[model samples]
Target chain A: MSQQLAVGIDIGGTNTVFGIVDRRGNILYDGKMSTKAHGDITSFLNELKERLDVLIDKVGGKDNIRGIGVGAPNGNYYTGTIDYAPNLRWRGIIPLANLLQDYFDVPAVLTNDANAAAIGEMTYGAARGMKDFITITLGTGVGSGIVANGQLIYGHDGFAGELGHCIVIPGGRVHAGTGMRGSLESYASATGVMLTALEFMDSRPEQDSMLRHTPRELVDSKVIFEAAKQGDPLAIEVYEYTGMVLGAALANFVMFSSPEAIVLFGGLTKAGDMIMRPVRHHMEINLLPIFQNKVKLVFSELKESDAAILGASALAWEMKTDQKAETPQP
Target chain B: MSQQLAVGIDIGGTNTVFGIVDRRGNILYDGKMSTKAHGDITSFLNELKERLDVLIDKVGGKDNIRGIGVGAPNGNYYTGTIDYAPNLRWRGIIPLANLLQDYFDVPAVLTNDANAAAIGEMTYGAARGMKDFITITLGTGVGSGIVANGQLIYGHDGFAGELGHCIVIPGGRVHAGTGMRGSLESYASATGVMLTALEFMDSRPEQDSMLRHTPRELVDSKVIFEAAKQGDPLAIEVYEYTGMVLGAALANFVMFSSPEAIVLFGGLTKAGDMIMRPVRHHMEINLLPIFQNKVKLVFSELKESDAAILGASALAWEMKTDQKAETPQP
Candidate 1:
């Protein structure tokens, strides 16, 4: 059988999603499993290989598969390892690409999920035909991928483009994950919205709202979005604040690279105009006259998981045939 | 005579400097002229042409010259024009490259001064042999040039790498030039140092210092440096604060591109360890663990004007022979 499909894996904090995709961005087969269920990297690898084998057989066996690509938090493109990923059960460096390639008998590649999303955007999404753009993922954690001169800025360490970690507040909110003070991720992510919602409702006890009744643990970006839809002023303020910080950060990014557009992705983007209006307004006001009003700000058309899967899959197309047999072990 | 020399011009607000340079980076002949000595740009061009002709003749005529390269405020590499340079006598867009090429009958290239410094550093200074690094000029104003994958990131509008304008403090300080709040330039440039020194001394009226004795008009970064060297606590605090903000901004730039080193240029760097200590401290504290302590922060080895001249000259090497005749008029 001709090699016509690539396996794409998106490793998330809670769940691991994988798909077999063709060249045209079609997901021929896909499935999900608990990322932490197996506890150890070895057990997780065993289960992944077992599950993937069944999908491989269904898709006319291994010969029909082109290669594999994995997108994980803290993934390093140059080393093909996941280094010190905060959310992962396994600590330190894991040579995931080597393991996956050895198990599947095909070439494998890995990159931080945001970088994968950027490539996916360039190849199949909003950034198509554009040589310069940025993809910002606003989810549980903010992630970013910067593309300039038609290539991802992997930097010297393959860890460039961490816009989420860039300080926006300057000694303001403390980030729980990285212990970073006033990072864009700390203020603009879904978790940030929840934190903001809780603080706003708690501080303004007299400002009666539906969110005031919701348990603090149960309150998330979705609850805030729902209340916001119902014209909750406090909730609306949360989106505005989030967009303000995000917009300021976006302006900073704009000055750094002056990309043609900034593609926003993930959960918080669902807030839509509630977030974008302020983002656009702040970004414009902060920019120099030469850079004002030129960048296109758009939403990612691909579903969150699908975009990650497709983006990871896009990497496999670059694998050379000789890459399959050469392995760099951890 | 062989075409082994390039004419380099550094256009500044007060004075314009030009040099006839050999391929190995030696300035064979150099001269300076008052940029505003001529009221209009047309007169300035005529004077510049007449002066350059003498230098060209000294170097065996125009036939020996490879091309011309210019570094100026608001220079656009793509359009070869100076667009709305606030400091320059000429306003709006001036097609300097086209005019120079037409006069000298050779190709002419232009980029912002900071970018020229970057190319110069890469070719003949501290950044030599490094593929990825940033050159930051902290002069009367802050300017930057970013190099990644061995190419300057000009962005979509030929105006990328404006690290100076990136908001580091987020509404903390108002920039005089652009009126933007809390920009890196507002807090880190030489002008910023003067402002900080004044604020520091005024905020503590009881504190007796050398700066208090100097007239406010005469007090500048040099005065502050002298005061700082004398162990004046208030002046030292000003540098500490400047370094703190500059370091935080540097951390942001590091996270953006992950360059191997950040080369510091211009007047403020002359303060040496007085500023570098706090900059390194604040930058390390602000960065995530993965990025901490990896980037080398060093001062530019080239003299201020020479670096700009050499950097502008470097652009001439890239001009294709055929590029000389095809002029794009502004």
Candidate 2:
């Protein structure tokens, strides 16, 4: 817990991961525990606190901790609060950072998991060498973190990078964030891919797809991706459709941000070519007249823990460095 | 002749508008001339040259003119060129600013029209008091100028702020600009609105709609707005659809740039409430959780001439003043 080591916590819908990371992006000690299934907000924090106490005790105490950084669903960096994240049962606004700060007796910060990924990319992942780019996490839902002019655009508050919910199909399907129908998340997200696969199978039963042998509950995007790699039309179609949506949405992103590159992260993106080819093809086709030839789509090259932890740490690191630099050396 | 006035030219697909203006956002002289359908690029410049000669003569010879500021499609501020506007029938890059500089024997500058409008708004219009905002023009296509931290976001190659072509409705419609289908332009642009309106009227063939009498050639969003105001369900639907698309796109924009406001311009947006109501309703709803209670969406208050001309002039002013400020003067 020395001030040289910062605590990095990645609070997910299912698990809460905590670590002591140094300025060099090294995790010295780490621990994890199950999140409250009942969505009991205080109970969840109490459990995390108990685990953190063990880690702190091993490191000689809380006074040694410089700061705490949290990567969470619906987390806001500027406000340090978590809004309604359905995956977690917590309701209303939770002062996540403040809660951690109070229990740990150290400065703490919290931001969306995706924003943390972007920062992680900038500091330790595929986008490490870049100053301006977007990091997209193709997870349960599509989450993106944007870096422009070497800073995260927290946008008046901290909800600037909700890329998944932008309407990709205006009247297509009901999306979660916007309550609008047919967002990119509706068609390209992992769940969306599974839905497409099910529909494809139901609509075209004659297709001898490998996915036909997979159980319904286990019929997620990974099986579809594997089937596509082995040349299954139905599975390939799922990737194609997902890529098309991603490409179209990415093209729009290019017009707005003009970032140097776009890096994809998370499980769904692990399909790589199965996901990228269509995205690139469609992205190139839909980009602005001038932006057509520029901009590259690539995959994130960071460990999951690295992106989330580093990104969360970036929030505190950037803030601390900026503050320190601005303190006016007498 | 004097530094007080410069000739500002904005060349669009159909018309080439030229104006003589001073330091203030005032047009002392202005004229509109057709770009002359399909001709040599030099001929267009010659025609402009001849016009400038007459103006110089009117101002007691060439010494009375300061320089020139040109706003053209595909104009690159970094390169001082107009690089192929498809509708202009100019298929290659042309050193537009250099050509004018050579002709007038003084300084000249060039940039894309959207950027010009941004400068115009920043220096003299609704955004005069703001430093971070975006100006979106919903004409035949969607055009945008981004102002971030008090400067335009021209990325490494100077091609940034292509807001209209960003994907709002992925796979919704095949659109211009990169041939990516279903962009913001395809749904929210004037051309996009026309497509949506036609689709709207067709969707409700049996409805009591005023669009029944609207001529195809003269048909536009205005007719739809007037009808929507008069309680036409179909027309209201059109506006609602357009605004929702705009709002959804704006939410993404807010995430990327975190601008103070988004200022709407151009013909399609003139429908005012017809366009804004939906955009606001949808944008506010889908906004990043943090931006939910904050962020403002507004319309431009600058006349085209005032904003465009001023924007063009401001480009030149930025260049010349930047040079002056950098020069080691005794």
lDDT (10s digit) by residue, model 1, range A1-330 = 588999999998899999999988889899998998867888998889999899999999999988898899999987899998888998899989888877888789899999999988887789987777999999888889998888788888888999899999988888998888899998899889988888888888889888877887899899999999999899999999898999989999999999998999998888899999999999999898889999999999777758878999988875666664233221
* Interface RMSD to the true structure, each candidate: 0.7, 2.6
TM-score of each model, paired residue for residue: 0.94, 0.79
Task: Encode model 2's per-residue lDDT on A78-186: one tens digit a residue.
Answer: 6777887767878888877777767777788778888888887787667776756888888878888887767665654456677776666656867655566776778
Q: What lDDT is reached at residue A235 by model 2?
A: 91
Q: Choose the strongest candidate by DockQ.
A: 1
How well does each candidate reproduce the native contacts, as fnat? Answer: 0.79, 0.55
Estimate every model's Cα lDDT from 0 to 1. Answer: 0.88, 0.75
For candidate 2, the iRMS in Å is 2.6
Chain B alone: TM-score in each candidate?
Answer: 0.95, 0.90
Model 1, B79-119: lDDT tens digits are 89899888888878898888887777878999899999998
Off by over 4 Å in 1: A1-4, A53-66, A318-330, B1-3, B58-64, B319-330
Candidate 1 all-Cα RMSD: 2.7
